[model samples]
Target: MKIGEVSGHASVPVETIRYYEKIGLLLKPDRDASDYRVYGNAHLNRLLFIKRCRNLDMTQDEIRELIRLSENPEADCHEVDALLARHLIHVRDRLSELANLETALQQLQQACSKTGTVEQCGIMGGLSSELGGLSDKDTDQRNHVPGTHKPGSH
Candidate 1:
């Protein structure tokens, strides 16, 4: 099969396949007499694996490490477990951060629910106010000014 056919079968762009090859993520395919890149079942399988890893939100470096481990089938599986554990921790942290952001946005939305002039808007008032160096309980302490009540001082 040609590069286009392989990409079509994998449901990925031809440019992506070429980029994977360029980045050494995917092996370069053999060329025909006309120099058209030829692909085989092995390439297709590898592309599918890469796609699955991407869907799992694995980084390129993580995927590279996985591929290396896959090549060495005799290697212990404990390292793979550890890698996944680390990735899970990162995902959990991101989820917690997103939840906090959602809460803040909800509060902002509530502030805007009441009809008023722009200057009288609670959301704008909160944003524009100096807060007198006051900080929210949820605000990161690292950004808080010592003995200050300002919200945006950081």
Candidate 2:
């Protein structure tokens, strides 16, 4: 099949498939007589596996490692177990962080319950205090750090 055919069957975008090839996650497909990319069942299966791994929020490095381990069918499952355990811990940490973020947002929302001018807006005052590095001591410092980016950065 052609690249587009495989992409449609696998539900992965063509650009992503090309990127996977570039990143060494997916092998480059063979070309036809017209130099068009040709894909096969192996590519489709691999693409599906990669998509599943991505859906699990696994890092590219982790997916790569799993793929490497997958090549050796006789290898012990301990390494895979360890990797999953680590990922679970990371997921739990992110959940906790998200919960804290929600709480912080709730507190910020409650700062100004009534409608008013910007000058009298408590929410704006809290945000301004945060930007000025004068945030309340009770605020969650971990999630409140302002992110910085260079101009025109994605």
Candidate 3:
């Protein structure tokens, strides 16, 4: 099939396919007599694998490593386990960060429950204090520090 067909079937953009080829992630397809690229089942399968990895939030480098491992079926899977573990840690950390952000936003929302001028708004005051270079530790304990939260708990 052509690039467009492959992209549609794989649910990935054509540019992304081109980039994968450019970065040696995907092998370049053969060209037909008319100069159109000729892709095959191998390309389709590889593209789908790449798409699935991306959907799982795996980085490009990680995908590359996985592809390498796949090419060497005799290689031990310990490294693959390690890579997945690392990615899980990152995902857990991000989930914790997002939860903390939600809590902070909730607190900020409550700051000015009653409509008032800018001088009387607590949310604005907190934001301004942050922008003014006040240390996160120096701020009220109720205020959430963006990156200080632990994983798996709000």
Candidate 4:
């Protein structure tokens, strides 16, 4: 099969496959007489596994470790378990941070609920606060803060 065939069957983009190869995640495929890259079942299988791991939000390093462990069929899975537990903890911490962000946004919304013109808009006032860098005209700080609440549709 060709690289395109592997990409289509594995649901990974051609660019991503090339990047994996460059990053040493995927081995470079053999070339044919026409110099076109030729992939086999092993490449397809590996690409699919990597896609599944990415879908699960596993980092590249974690995926590499998993691949190394997979090569040792007789090895115990304790390291895999530990890695998953650590990922779970990171997820939980992010959730907590999001909750705090939600509360802050709610408070900001409440502060701006009063009817006012554009000149007296509460939401704008909160965004243009003294600490919001509006005085310095630095709007790049707008989305720099993580876990922000997007006040959309309401």
The TM-score leader among the candidates is 2
What are the Cα lDDT values of the candidates?
0.78, 0.81, 0.82, 0.76
- Candidate 2 wrong stretches, greater than 4 Å: 132-154
Quick one: how many clashes does candidate 1 have?
A: 5
Per-candidate TM-scores read: 0.75, 0.83, 0.78, 0.75
Candidate 1 lDDT by residue in tens digits, 10-120: 999999999999998899999999999999999999999999988987777778888988998998999899878877776676567677767866887677848879988
Worst 10 residues of 1 by lDDT: 145-154
Per-residue lDDT of 60-97 in model 4, one digit per residue for the tens?
Answer: 78788888888998989998898777667655755787
- Over 4 Å off, model 3: 117-121, 134-154
TM-score of 4: 0.75
User: How many collisions per candidate?
Assistant: 5, 0, 0, 0
| Candidate 1: regions farther than 4 A off | 114-154
Candidate numbers, best lDDT first, in rank order: 3, 2, 1, 4
Candidate 3 weakest ten by summed lDDT: 145-154
Q: After superposition, how far is residue 94 of candidate 3 from its true place, in Å?
A: 1.4
**Model 4: residues >4 Å from true position, as ranges?**
114-119, 130-154
Residue range 77-141, candidate 3, lDDT tens digits: 99899889888877787678778778877888788857879889999987787579957554446
In candidate 3, the residue pairs with backbone N, CA or C atoms under 3 Å apart (3 or more residues apart, or in different chains) clash, namely none
Which of the two, 3 or 4, has more TM-score? 3
**lDDT winner, 1 or 4:** 1
